[model samples]
Target: MSEANECLFCKIIAGEIPSNTVYEDDSTIAFSDIHPKAKVHVLIVPKKHYANVAELAEQDSHELSHMVGIAKSIADKEFHGAYRLIFNTGEDAGQSVFHVHAHVLTGEVMAE
Candidate 1:
C-alpha cells in the first residue's frame, strides 16, 4: 500500500477508522483528540496527506490557514475564543503521526 493509504489520519478521513469529528469540510476535518493534553483538545487535519506542518505549508498554505480558522472556530465554541495552537513537525518534536495536523488546546490556563 502507498504511504497515504497506511496513514492513520487518512483512514480516519476515509471513514475506515472512527473519530470524534467536530468539524469537516472539503479540505479539512477537525476531531477530538483521543489522548488530549488539554480539557478541550482537538486536531485540525487536512483531508489531503502531508508529512508535517512545514510540508503542508509548502504544498498548500491556504489549507494550512483553513485549518487554523477551524481551530479558532472550535475555540470560539468550546473555550471563549482563547486557545493555543500546536504543530508538532517531526518525530523529535513529538509528532507521532506523519500526517500533518494542528492541535487546538484550550478550556484552562495553559502551563508556561
Candidate 2:
C-alpha cells in the first residue's frame, strides 16, 4: 500500500478509521487523541497527507496556519484559550503516525 493508504491519520480523514471528530473543515479535521496527554487533547490534521510539519510547510503553509487556527479555536471552546501546540516531526521527535498533525493540549497546568 502507498504511504497515505497505510497512514492511520489518512484513514481517519478518509473515514475508513473512526475518530472522535471535534472539528472539520474543507481542508482540515480535528479529533480527540486516543491517548490524550492533557485534559483537552486534540489532533488537528490536514485532510491531505503530509509526512511532517516541514513537508506541510513547504507544500502547503496555508494548511499549517489553518491547523494552528483550528487548534486555537478548539482551545477557546474547550478551555479558556490557553493552549499548547506541538508538531512532532519524526520518530525521534515522537511522531508515530507519519502524517503531519498538530497536538492541541490545554485545560491543565503543563509542567514547564
**Clashing pairs for predicted structure model 2, backbone only:** none
lDDT of 2 by residue, 1-112 (tens): 7999989999899999899999998999999999999999999999998999999999999899888889888888878898999999999989899999999999887896
For all predicted structures, in order, the TM-scores are 0.97, 0.97
User: What does candidate 1's lDDT look like per residue over 3-111, in tens digits?
Assistant: 9999999999999999999999999999999999999999999999999999988989999989888988998998899999999988999999999999999988898
Whole-model lDDT values for every prediction: 0.93, 0.92
**Going through the candidates in order, what is the number of backbone clashes in each?**
0, 0
Estimate the overall C-alpha local distance difference test score of candidate 1.
0.93
Count backbone clashes in candidate 1: 0
Angstrom error at residue 2, model 2: 0.9
List ranges where model 1 is wrong by over 4 Å: none
Error of 2 at 22 (Å): 0.2
Q: Give the C-alpha lDDT of model 2.
A: 0.92
